[model samples]
Target: MASRVTMIAHLFGAMATILMLVWLLHYRGGIDLDSDSNSDRIFNVHPFLMFFGFIFIAGEAIMGYRTVAAERKVQKLFHMVMHLIAITLGIIGIYAVFKYHDEIGLSDMYSLHSWIGLGTFCLFGLQWLFGFFSFWLPKSSLATRETMKPWHIFGGRALLYMAICSALTGLMEKATIMGLKRGNESRLINFTGLFILLFGLAVDLSLSLAY
Candidate 1:
C-alpha cells in the first residue's frame, strides 16, 4: 500500500512538473535569467522556480525515507542535500520576483501572496538551519537527537504545506491580476494548482506512513 501510494505520488508529481513547464515555457514564453529587460519573461521564472525548484524539491526531500531504499545515514544525507538544493533555488526564485517588480516599476510586497511567500521562506530557512546545527554541525547527543526528531519532522511537514499555501495564493494572484484569458488559459492554471496541491498531500502522506 505504501509503495502503491508512493507511485501515485510520483505520477502526480511528474504530471504537475510537465504542466507547469508547458505553461511557463509554451504559454509564458519560457524563463529568462539574464534579461530583466522583459519583465514578463522574468516573471515567468518566479513561478517555475518557486513551484518546481522549492516546493517540488522539498517534497522529494520529505519523501526520501520512503522513496529511497538506502541506509539511514544515506537517507538522511540525501534528504539534507535535496533540501539544500531547494533552498538555493528558492533564493533565486525570490530574487527573480523582486527583480521582476523592479523592472516593471511595481512596488513590492503589496500583495497577500508576497506576504505569505516571504514569511514561509524565512521560516523554511530557519527550519533548515536548526536541522543542520542539531543533526550535523556539532552532532547532538543521541538522546537529544531522538528528542528533536519528531519536532524536526513535524516542522518539515508544516513548512511544506505553508509553501503550498504560498504557491496556491500566488497562482490566484497571478491569474486574477493578470486577467488570464477566460477559457483554456485559466483552466490550465487551475489544473496546475490542483496538481500542486495533490503533490503536496501525497508527499505528506508518504512521510507519515514511512516515518
Candidate 2:
C-alpha cells in the first residue's frame, strides 16, 4: 500500500514537471522564435509553472523521504533540497529578467540570477552523477561518501534558499506581465500547490504510523 501510494505521488510529480518544462521552454525564458512581447511579459508562463511546480515537487520529495530507510533518508532529503533550489533559481531568473527589461543587455540582476541558476544546475548535475555512479564506488573510499553526503547537503540548502528567492522573483515577473496588475490567478495557482503539498504531507504522516 505504501509503495503504491508513493508511486502515485511520484507519477503525479513527474507529470506536473513535464507539463511545466514544456510550457516554459517553448514560450517563456529563452530567446527562440522571437515573439511580440516585452521583457515584463516574457516570463509569464515560465513563472506560472515554476511557482506551482516547485510546490508540488517539493512536497513529493518530502513525503517520499518518509518511506526510505534512515541511511537513505539523508540522500533523499538532499535530492529534495537540490530540486527545491533549482526551482528557486528559475523563479529568481524570472524576476531578474523583468528587472533588466529596459536595459536590453546583460544587466547586473541578470548576471547574478544567471550565476545562481547555473550553480543550481551544476549541483543537480552532480546529484545525478552520484546516483548514476552509486553502484560502482569502492567500499573503502571516503571520497565518495564525503562528496555524496556533506557536499550534497550543503549544496541542497543553498539551493533551497535560492529557490525561495526565485519564487519571489517569479511573482514579480507575473505582476509585470499583467502590466503592474494583481489578480487571483497566480494566487490561486500557488494556493492549489500549497494545498496539494499540505495534503500530501498529511497523508504521508498518517500512513507512516501504519507502516
lDDT of each structure?
A: 0.87, 0.49
**Top lDDT prediction, candidate number:** 1
Q: In terms of TM-score, how similar is model 1 to the real structure?
A: 0.95
Estimate the TM-score of every prediction.
0.95, 0.43
**In model 1, which runs have C-alpha deviations exceeding 4 angstroms?**
none
lDDT of candidate 1 over 25-57, digit per residue (tens) = 878888897674567888888999999899988
Clashing pairs in 1: none
Cα shift from native, residue 56, model 2 (Å): 3.9
The Cα RMSD in angstroms, rounded to one decimal, for candidate 1 relative to the true structure is 1.4
Alpha-carbon deviation at 14 in model 1, angstroms: 1.4
